[model samples]
Target: MGVIVDEQVLTCSIPPARFFKAFFVDSNNLFPKILPTVFKSIEYTEGNGGPGSIKLLSFQEGSGADVMKHRIEEMDEANLVYKFKIIEGPKMGVLDFESVSSVNKVEGAADGGCILKSVVTYNTKGDNQNAIQETIKKAKEGFVGFFQATVGHLQSNPDAYN
Candidate 1:
């Protein structure tokens, strides 16, 4: 299997703690509400909400994916770090990936805002470098779009996640 790693950083005006809380901690609840066009719902299938837990995420029609299963690897609230692995999804099948995992860290920036750093690792089935790169690029763009939408929601609501 071929292993591919990618990193992305996004900066926003929200504080690290609050951003982490909204984006990572309460994402299951907030995402479906805020981005209904993309997410249908996120429900825990096993093990509560901590490490080893499985979450079944259902997406809306035309979103390019129907459902995805994610296993929580780690969630460090105090440190503002989260990690998860995609165990099942149509996107994985289409991309020919054996496994996909991501680690996200939120840190306070000097400007009183926050920076989100994400590292994604993809285990592929064959030696299709171009296909893998394209998949990774699209995934990163989706992540950024989601982050921007969540940030906009939080910025406008102010008291929503607080």
Candidate 2:
């Protein structure tokens, strides 16, 4: 199998605590409500939400319309870190990957904002590493756009979640 990895660090004006609360804690409800154009819903199918739990994210029609299944590998609330593996989804088809793992870490900034570091690794099925990497590059653009949209939503309606 082949492997492809991507990493990114994003600086945002939202505090780490609030960011995690809105994105990870309340995301199941807030994501769909806030970004209806991108996501349809996010729900747990196996466990309540801790490690080993499985969650399915259903995207909006034409926004892939894919149900991505993810298994939580680790959750460190104190440090604000989350790790998960994507077990199934349309993304697998496009990249021809056996699995995909994502690790996200949020660090509090002195200015009440935060820096988010994200690492995504793709395990491919064959030798089409170039093609897979290209696809992943394109997907990352959309993913970043979605993140920006979420941040905008939170900033504009701060009390909506608080």
Local distance difference test, each candidate? 0.90, 0.82
Tens-digit per-residue lDDT, 1-162, candidate 2: 877788988878888877876777667887888788878899999998899999999998887547889899988878889899988887476557888999999998888898889999988887776777776887788767767876898799787555
Q: What lDDT score goes with residue 63 in model 2?
A: 74
Model 2 regions more than 4 Å off: 93-95, 160-162
Give lDDT: candidate 2, residue 127. Answer: 79
Give the candidate number with the greatest TM-score.
1
Can you give the lDDT of residue 85 in candidate 2?
A: 94
Q: After superposition, how far is residue 43 of candidate 2 from its true place, in Å?
A: 0.8
| Model 2 TM-score, all chains together | 0.89
Against the hidden reference, what TM-scores do the models get? Answer: 0.94, 0.89
The deviation in Å at residue 160 for candidate 1 is: 2.5
- Candidate 2 lDDT score at position 112: 88
Model 2 accuracy (lDDT, Cα): 0.82
